[model samples]
Target chain A: MADTSSPPALHFTGHRHLVERLVLSTLTGRPIRVTKIRSSSVTDPGLAPYEVSFLRLLEAVTNGSQIEFSYTGTALAYRPGLITGSAAGHGASIDGVLRHEIPASCTRGVSYFLLPLCLLAPFSKSPVNVLFTGPGVITSATPTGDVSVDTVRTAILPIYEQFGIMNKLEIRTTQRSNPGPGGKGGTGEVQLIFGHQVRLPKTVHLLNPGRVKSIRGVAYATGVSGANNARMIEAARGVLNPFVPDTRIFSENTAAGFVPAPERNNAAAKRKMGVGFGLSLVAETSTGVRFSADVAVPVEGGVPPEDIGRKCAFQLLEAVEKGGCVDVVAAFTALTLMAMGSEDVGRIQIGRDVLGSEDIVQLARDFKTFGLSGWGLRDAGEGSEDIIVSIVGRGVGNVGRKVA
Target chain B: MPSLAPLGKRKRPTEAPKSAPATKPAPGTKAAEPESDGDSDLQAIFKRAFEAKFAPLPFAPAADEGNHESAEEEDEDEDEWTGFDSESESESESVPAPVVVVHSTPSRALEIDKSELKAFLSSKPPTAAKPTPFPSSGPKPTPAEDEDSAANLKNDVALQRLLSESHLLSADRTSGALDPTGKNRHKALDLRLQALGAKGSLFKQEKMPMAHRKGIVRKGAERETKRRKEAKEAGIVLEVAQKAKGKSVGRRERAVDAPAVGRFRGGTLVLNSRDVASIEGPKFKSKGKGKRRR
Candidate 1:
């Protein structure tokens, strides 16, 4: 929409961190170009189904976006437009909800889309209302390492509250499902309503990785015996009770979801999908810092419920032992909000391991390419291995917001 | 007290002669060996008895020993007393070992409140309005305050019930009791449910003959007018009656594909005079007092 000179598109390579880069482009109203997206793989190359579905979702939410792919589907270019959320007469339906259907070929969990959508919601012109449904909507953790929807609600969303974006936020799971056979797809439904928007996120200094005071969790069994939930809770509590006596893990059980799978002769045929059990645990510190762990049964399904529970408990302890204000699961969100804050610098003390990961390293490189300032890091204190990262905002806040 | 009294009395008679070896050591020298042991034993008995009735002695009997010899002598005397003292003292010491067994509670007690669990597990993220109230922080309400709250709640509920069900309570109807009987009770419950935000009364008949429904409406209106007339005669003010709603004169819902201004009859479009007049231009009136222009 700009007739004047706009900045040239930032160049990148490979498909890694595609969602994060696209989100940054949308927020800053910049154009991005990338080459060699899984180009090395001969059998299957270019963007995956879930990634293309995410791009479609972005087009639905924003006003005047453009996306193009090369002939081989490797190279790509995207020019982002104003984020007009779920405004009526757009792709939104009568109820003001944008219905997005995931194809049955998708393997990644629904959280793969949800986490990035939340980062963009607070800067949109209006509220973001999306209803995710279809056979590919896996509500449980997938073997591909995507977390479950429950963890997103229990763990990641609370971090936004620290940034002063904490009103009218909700995630409603109408149907719960685990990954289907071979980790392919599941029939599930989820709705996300994010009504809070701001001119700019508030600056924050989360320096203290406080002591863990309580643990809360959810154990769910879909289309399986609810005794699986009991077994999982028993095993998880057996481990966590010694450390924090104030632990509570609630149990949820539901019937398996059904999707139409019509054969040649039978047109009304339907089959059950997403039948499994899983557990998600969240540990909240005294200062409201949250560390989360999630584990689900694989589609081949030989592992016992007790094993899943014990594995999740140990996972939570490992996250807590990393010793940071934000764990690896939530570090991206915290760091992004800090970099997108008002002009002042926001500081956060993160675990050395979490900061040294590939995702954060790539983000640092992408920031430099986007003409944003580099991060300033120093040791946290006397005995901590944590590095306190200080990020200065670009002072280019929400372009969609009209009010002060 | 009586049991210990008899035991002490029995021990005193045997101990009086045992002290004869310490002061007159010549004649009782042969007996002095056991008698010296018995004399120290008697000192221990008196120490225990004095400490039991009053405060303990500041100094121990072993403190009087000047060097290692007297300490050895005290140890030798104690070795002989365990074999020589009565059996009841040893029995009381052995009885306390079994009582020290440690008993632990269950590691996790799933004592969750139903409402709290439902709220936490609901679709929305649990609002951090209140953190999980640990069972350890359970506040103990005082009995006096509990009683006061209970009485106040009971009075409030009674007052609300009376206000909502006042019409059901009449002198001829069960002599002005708080609760009505049979059909009136059901009606009272329906009224309460409607007040609680139910869309309509549960007893409202959805299907009925048109004539019967109209008759009931007329009878209700007649009854209301009679009550208003009586109230007016007695010089008592009454609420104004609400006027009945008029029939709607708005546009009817039509199908999306239907023609706007014509009816399709037998594959032919027919428009009325008003529709045709609207399609044509409005005719301008000629001014009588001015020149008429083309």
Candidate 2:
């Protein structure tokens, strides 16, 4: 038995103070509208007002805690989208005889020729700092030019992958004159624009250098005449899109109905062949959030009970990944028919008996309320009890099933 | 011994001068002799004067004869009062007794007159003074007085009984005794009364039965026992829960992916959207173009 001594009541008084402090700091940094604020009895009153509110929200959503809120105005929920980009720049300088003579030449050829020469030139004995500024700041500087873009897309990659989002990449370059007077006038700029987008088989890591190397030849240039600048930006944006996918997928699968008796059986045996089908449902609530659920039922004599169970389990797993609701009642009804014997016609056991009258009524109500238009179901084989059912909704839906 | 010498030559005759009685008498020797003579003469004079002053003078012959006649008449009066003179010799012997008798009769006569005066005063009226009885030579004992003594003795006995009862009661209260040896019923009764008085004050006019007091005490004991048991059970459960929670928290900590901001010792960089756009566009373009030109 669970030792249920009285747990101390949560005093929210302490959280009030903490919430105030947190809200003050957040407001000081940036103005934000407080759409809803709730204080839970379980929260410590010492918590800052903002922190307490945030924690209370977290508890309410995750722990099934009831929450009450006084909202001042409508709160805008943030819709997360894919974010993608690349860290790119160059760092080098020419000095002494080569630096002096390169700019002295009048022809563009000489200037262009000097580029490769600088690339091939021996390392300078004198060290000079080369600062590269771009879309992402260089958090740290090393002699070797390496940069990192630490943003939300990169931070939430794992969460995105769990939802089955994919990432793709692209790169591009541009040309411009060096700002310094040393150049003849025109200079070539190799702008490596990294682009990414969601793709299938979400397990793939977009930030992997190997993936970047594979996509090197694909310039990913969209149609734009003489618009080198626009091309570069598009290429970078494209690379970043695949880095974070904004799409969400939800799906579920289940089996329904009973099997028929042997051919030689009497009228009672013929009655055993019940109507049941497999069902699968998938729905996407948001670009990156999906909900799915599934249920499967066995057909007597047509399919093995183990097979039916495995199919049902697989349907549920698929639904879970989809992150949506399922029509549990219909799925259970179908499963019960499949489990019925030919001799047991007109008998259904739900919650310890053949589908109880109340259970049937509840099943119908559940179906009517949560059933989506695009739900799917499929039977395993002709005269076989094997069936799959799937349904999807905004989020995880009602989960109910008869043990029998 | 009187060796006189000049002051200057005193030293020369110093031994001789000192021999002037090697000890000349003390300075007041001559004056002391005269004072001693005067003291002896004064003492002799005082003795003579004291003798002359205390000597009694001789009586006159006539006064002696008068006193003799008064003595003879007193003898005659005595002889007359004696009515019987037995033998002459017996009479002579009884003569002295008659003189005593004669003198006593006069005194008797004076006492009779005083008695008569007292009688006359006493007989005068109803307002006569009652003779006051003389104080008894020793303390007069009364039955009431004896009763008082008896009461005192009883009080001592009562006091001793009370003291013993108190000692026993205190011991009983501390030792939790309902009844001790039954030798002294009175002591027991007293103890019981004291206990009742103490218990009575705690309640209103309605006396609390002994059984009810026991019931209340027993109930309190039962409640204490139950509370202790509950506390022990709660403590064990809390300990287990705490340990389980700690393990779970440790696992969660291991699973957490530390934010990149954690490495930002100086401060995390918060680049504005404009800054990011500039760097990604013109900055990249500038670097690329410069490379191409070179």
Report the C-alpha lDDT of model 2 over B13-78, residue by residue, as the tens digit: 222334322222212221222333555446445544554786421211122233344345445544
Clashing pairs in 1: none
What CAPRI-style quality would you assign to candidate 1? acceptable
Separate DockQ for every predicted complex: 0.26, 0.00
Q: What is the lDDT of residue B249 in candidate 1?
A: 72
Ten contiguous residues with the weakest lDDT in model 2 chain A: A208-217
The model with the greatest DockQ is: 1
For residue A209, give model 1's deviation from the true position in Å.
1.6
Which segments of candidate 1 are over 4 A away from where they belong?
A2-4, B1-106, B129-294
Candidate 2 residue-wise lDDT, A279-382, digit = tens: 22222222222222222222222443223323433433343332211122222312222221122112111121212334434433333332212223444334
Which runs of model 2 end up more than 4 angstroms from their true locations? A1-41, A44-76, A79-373, A378-404, B1-294
